[model samples]
Target: MIQTIAFYLFAGLMILSGVLTIMARNPVHSVLWLILAFFNAAGLMVLVGAEFLAMLLVVVYVGAVAVLFLFVVMMLDIDFASMRAGFMKNFPLGIAIALVLLAELVLGIGAYRAGALALGTPDGSAAPIVGVSNIQSLGALLYGPYIFLFEMAGVILLVAMVGAIVLTHREQKSVRGHQNIQKQVRRNPDEAVVMKQPTIGKGIEL
Candidate 1:
């Protein structure tokens, strides 16, 4: 009974937060609502005995991704009106896509209620090495069986980070405040500072 109540509560919150995220006026507020949705979704995962998945949702989506989105929305000088300029123009296309998604969701739920479709049975080569905790079990599965795939995912993320940095970075010749690291490093103490000793009453001049 307690589990059912918790499940319903979290599910409702998840749905509500997701709606609010989309309908929010402020982009920052939308990100905050998205984070709330992530938390509620994580709670639902916890209720379903997927504690590791819940933790990953909280840590990755809520902690990092959502927070980063919020920061980006707040810091970036984006014209929200300009961004939403094509809303009316794209309204029909958006509506069609949304309807298609809703239809798919209904079909999926109906199919699930009838019977779950079997995805695939794991090959015996990658057998599970049971550990004390779910996290440990997951780590064993990821590092032992799917280590190469995991490493490749890391490399992909590294390349993506580099790509993002390169895309956003602009070299402006008009910006006079740029620092020259090599020039600063090559400077001597003599050029940086002039050793000048002035008397108590008289000042020393060139």
Candidate 2:
């Protein structure tokens, strides 16, 4: 009964927050609603006994992705009125794409339900002869079977990070960077320091 109640509560909150995420006019408020939806979804996952997925949702999605979204929304100078002007222009295209995606999701779920797609059972049937913990099992499969793909994904993410840095990076003309530190250290005291005298009543000129 407790599980059922928690499930319903989480589901309701998730749905409400998801709707608010899209409906909110302010980008920061929308991101906040999205974070709430993620939290409720994580709760529902935990209630369902998928603690691994629940942790992933909380640690990865809620902690990193949602926080990044919040930061980006807060930092960006977005003109919502200009954005809204383009919304109606793309409404039909967006609706059509959403419908297509909905149809694809329905078809995928139907196929899974009908046993057209055979998913491996969690009873260690299709899993390797190893541990039963979800983390261990996933690690084994990822390292043993999908190592190349995993490495490829890491490389892709690294490239993406570099590209993002390059795009956002700028050279500051006013900021001086340290250079030739070793040379400066090896220089004589005469090159490094100078003592000067000025009139007692007047300040030294630059």
Candidate 3:
């Protein structure tokens, strides 16, 4: 079937791109590979009937996050030789983190296999509405039951962005041509501008 072939194609490409993303020496190339992986993952999501997720993968991950990452990698002056020199120093820490991640994955799999969690049976309430598009159903579910949580997340992100700006912002008294909106707003027009009335034949002195 075409679906099967497409699924395999997407999956294979996604896996290959993921490997390339990690293996590429150039950070910019790695980001490009990452974007490719995101595209293939989006394709897989479409094949799995989760079109909403596919759109999010392409729009958010590929469009925004990956582009931002590529720009950051390209802008930075990375010393690859120096980084490679420090690899052995950081190898033990990396190995420890990897082991921790592996242990977490094993625990998650064991718990899933044990099936001890008593999640309540799905009453048709959470199910997608008949004859509705995937995006519509997902939007309804998110807005209907999770509106407050969604708003809270937005607020948190807004606060975090503002906080980052505040933390990084430095007022420069030594720098010329700095903008002071409040100072400009409160200035008297008479002090800033003078009415010059001179005699017809006399030159006005500044």
Q: Pick the candidate with the highest TM-score.
A: 3
Q: Which candidate has the highest lDDT of all?
A: 3
**Candidate 1: stretches off by over 4 Å:** 83-85, 105-118, 122-131, 167-206
TM-score of predicted structure 1: 0.71
lDDT of residue 119 for candidate 2: 80
Better by TM-score, candidate 2 or 1: 1
Rank by TM-score, highest first. Answer: 3, 1, 2
RMSD of 3: 8.2
Candidate 3 per-residue C-alpha lDDT over 1-206 given as tens digits, one digit per residue, 9 for 90 to 100: 99999999999999999999987877888999999999999999999899999999999999999999988888889998787668768989999999999999998888878995555787888899899999999889889999999899999999999999999999866458778889999998767755578889886645
Worst 10 residues of 2 by lDDT: 124-133
lDDT of 1 by residue, 123-206 (tens): 776554554667777788788869999999999999999999999998977458888889899998666756479888886644
Flag clash pairs in model 1: none
Candidate 2, residues 1-206, lDDT tens digits: the string is 99989989999999999999988988899999999999999999888767789889999999999999999988989999987878878999999999999999999999999989998658753464454766677777888878999999999999999999999999966446657678778988755545458789885544
In model 3, the runs with Cα more than 4 Å from the true position are 114-120, 172-206
